[model samples]
Target: MSGGVDSSVAALLLKRAGYDVVGVFMRNWTEPDAAGRCSAEEDFADVRRVAEAIGIPYYAVNLEAAYREKVFAYFLEEYRRGRTPNPDVMCNREIKFGDFIEEALKLGADFVAMGHYARVRREGGRVLLLRGVDAAKDQSYFLHQLSQAQLSRALFPIGALTKAEVRRIAREAGLATADKKDSTGICFIGERDFRQFLKTFLPAQPGEIVNVDDGRVLGRHEGLMYYTHGQRHGLGIGGGFGPGPWFVAEKDLVHNRLYVAAGRDHPALFATALLAEDVRWIAGAPPDRVFRATAKFRYRQPDRPVEVEVLDERRAFVRFEAPERAITPGQSVVFYDGEICLGGGVIDRVRRPYFEARRSAFGDVFDRVLL
Candidate 1:
């Protein structure tokens, strides 16, 4: 349980169904915040209260070491390479379903259940992952990397219910977490400034912020790690430049420079195709030689039509039917056929719409080209 209304209601529903429900809270991060407060302790306290109110036994398992080695190490490495990585996707794959499943089985459990907003179906001797009933809260995008084996042993008790329905169930049961606010953003960086938290691990290196269109230096950036593509707010580029604001277009790691475009619809922010590596297909193999499917470049993004070509077992080339803005590298591109989440991979590269124009204008600015 996550000490939230959804998980609390999930446990209550399972118990009401006459199943032997045991609440297991995984303590993933234990580091204290800047105020020297441990959020996990407060969350676990809520978990205990909910478990006692529901009359089910509960236990807390420490998985901090495994999380650090498996999920967090990759998160830091991706930032070091100037790529924005999704640690939640990796945490679900590596820690939650991977290590947490093993820990559950050791406790004599047949199935491991979570409060994920997704569903699983068994058909034709195959396990299929499906989007939750709540369209606005569907989380199948984050669970796209799950395997057949993981889905087979997993259960999502609250997948069929909406967020309001979940809170209602919790309130009816008199659960303590019925009115608890849902957690947002990265779990490790709770209530703290993201750039400040990141700087605790990765030292900030100041660099020049360059305007990609005219090759003019606009300002100095704190660090390339603190910015992301399509980010407009923190560019530090004030007025008098043009009639508009600026957005981060690209990161020139080799030159230690950050590139920005003047407008939101700048060509530098859009891409036509992307190359993904370390791909995984839920069906355990690739599909046809070339096939049309829908994919999400990021979580909660509407699925877009794409023609996927399998380059190898671990790589695929995806071309979007239309240009997509900020098709970032190091993020996962999840594929889907209707409600079925096929699988996903880490975005290794992108083919920008203004590649030729930037090359001609900036010459060797992007030596390590993302084109």
Candidate 2:
């Protein structure tokens, strides 16, 4: 539940619906702070308090080994290949719905539920994934990697309400987490300096920042893994030749150089069509070979029109009808039909303007669940 208002209300709703709800606070990893204490103690305590208030069975599960093997290792491997990996997506697939769901089922629970802002429905014995009613807080993007079996056993009680409504319901129920601040940054990592946390596991190779067009040195970057596709601030690059703020145009890992250009509209970074790998469709498969749908290349982005093509059983690609800015590698491209989730893949290649190709080696990582 993450000890948040959303999950607390989810438990309340399920309890009111006559379902035997057990509140679980999953401990994915032990991230100790500068004081040598696990940072998750506060959230865990809050979740426990909410569970006590709700009068349900509450327990904490340690999945640190699973998280390290599945998500953290993959994160380090992706960054080693010069790509930004979404650890949250991997956490959902490997920890929450994967290990936690199995644990819940093993404990004789009928179903596993969470505070995710997405919905799952059964139509004619086929399971379908749908977006949350609260569009602004929808989290189906992080859930694209769920397998058919996991989606069938999953429940999302907060899918019907907005964030504000969730808070209200929690307040009405007298839950302690009603006013709790939302957890931000990497799921297990919390709000620590991102690059600093990553440095512990990744080898830091200092590199140079240069202008994309002229190849002139602008500044020095800590490493290629320290930056992402569309980052603007904390670049430490001096600005003089631009009218507006500059954005990272490209990361040339081969030469260990970063390329910056003026503004987010830099032609070299925007892409019309994106090639995604490791695609998953929650509705079994796409209804048609070439179907029009709404696709998002990053989390918190509005869906855009696109045509999806199944390249193979394990790989697929989507071509956006309009150019997408910062269609970055390592980020997931989740597809949707109205509010229903159509599935998506990791963005492998973003086609740059004028035929320059930005490529990566970690283009197709997927489904590494331990048997």
Candidate 3:
């Protein structure tokens, strides 16, 4: 329980079902926030209270070292390479299901449960990952990388319920975290400014912010790492050029340049194809060498029709039926067949129409083609 209503309700539901539930809070980040306040300690306190109220034993297991080596290192490395990485995805795979499961098994636990808004089903001697009943809060995208073994030992008690129902259950049970606000953004970063928080690890390397359309130098950027594809608000590119606001269209790591587009719907902000590497299929292999399915480029994004071709074991090429906005690199592109989450992979490259048109002029600098 992360001192939240969702997990408290999950534990409550499991206990009510006559399952022996033990609350194990994995302490991943030990460092205090900018205000010198330790959020983990506060969260654990809530966890302890809820465990007591639910009549179950609870323990806090420190996984800081494992998280830093496995998840945090990869997060910084991706940003250093000018790609925005989703650390939460790695956190779920490496820390939550990976290390946390091992720890739970050591305690003679048969299955490890989490508060994630996702589900699993056993069919034909195979474990299948499924999206939660709450379409708006479905987190199967984050858990897509999990393997069959992990899914087999995983239980999501509240996957069939909506967020409102979760809060209602917690309140009715008199749980301490019934009204607690759900945590958002990167877990370690908390409510702090993302750009400022990233700066603590990656020092700002001031670079030029150039408009992709006209090549006009708009403003100075602190660093390409501070921006992401399709971001608009923080560009600081004041009005004068056009009626539309400036949006980050791409990052040129070779030149240390941040590329911007004038409008939100600019072609530079959309992509029809992408190449993903380090692919992990939950079923241990792709359904076929080529198949059609629905995919999500990021969490909370509505599913889109796509055609996927498995080039090899660790890579796949994806073609979207319609243009996808801000198909950012380093983000997981989760694939699904109906309710079944097939798997996902890290977005390695994208094919944008605006960039393709200028590829001849820019030479290899704009070449992100995978075909």
TM-score of each: 0.97, 0.92, 0.97
Better of 2 and 3 by TM-score: 3
TM-score of 2: 0.92
lDDT tens digits by residue: candidate 1, 130-227: 99999889988888888889889989999999999999888888999989999998888887888988898999999999888778888999999988
- Cα RMSD of all models vs. native, in order, equals 1.2, 4.6, 1.3
Question: TM-score of model 3 relative to the true fold?
Answer: 0.97
Give all candidates' CA lDDT scores: 0.89, 0.80, 0.90
Tell me the spans in candidate 1 whose CA falls farther than 4 Å from its real position: 363-369
**Candidate 2 lDDT, 1-371, residue by residue in tens:** 77888888999899999998888888877777645667578889998899889889888888889999999899999899788888888899888989988888888988888999998998888778888888889999999888889988989999988999999899888999998888777765665677788888887999888777666787888998888877898788665665537688777676787877777787766777767877777876776887888888887888799988887876776777887787788889998888888788887876665333322321222112000
Error of 1 at 102 (Å): 0.4
lDDT of candidate model 2 versus the reference: 0.80
Q: Which parts of model 2 are misplaced by more than 4 Å?
A: 35-37, 241-244, 355-371
Residue range 18-96, candidate 3, lDDT tens digits: 9999999989886888788888999999999999999999998999999999999999999988888989989989989
Model 3, runs deviating above 4 Å: 368-371
For candidate 3, which ten residues in a row score worst on lDDT? 362-371
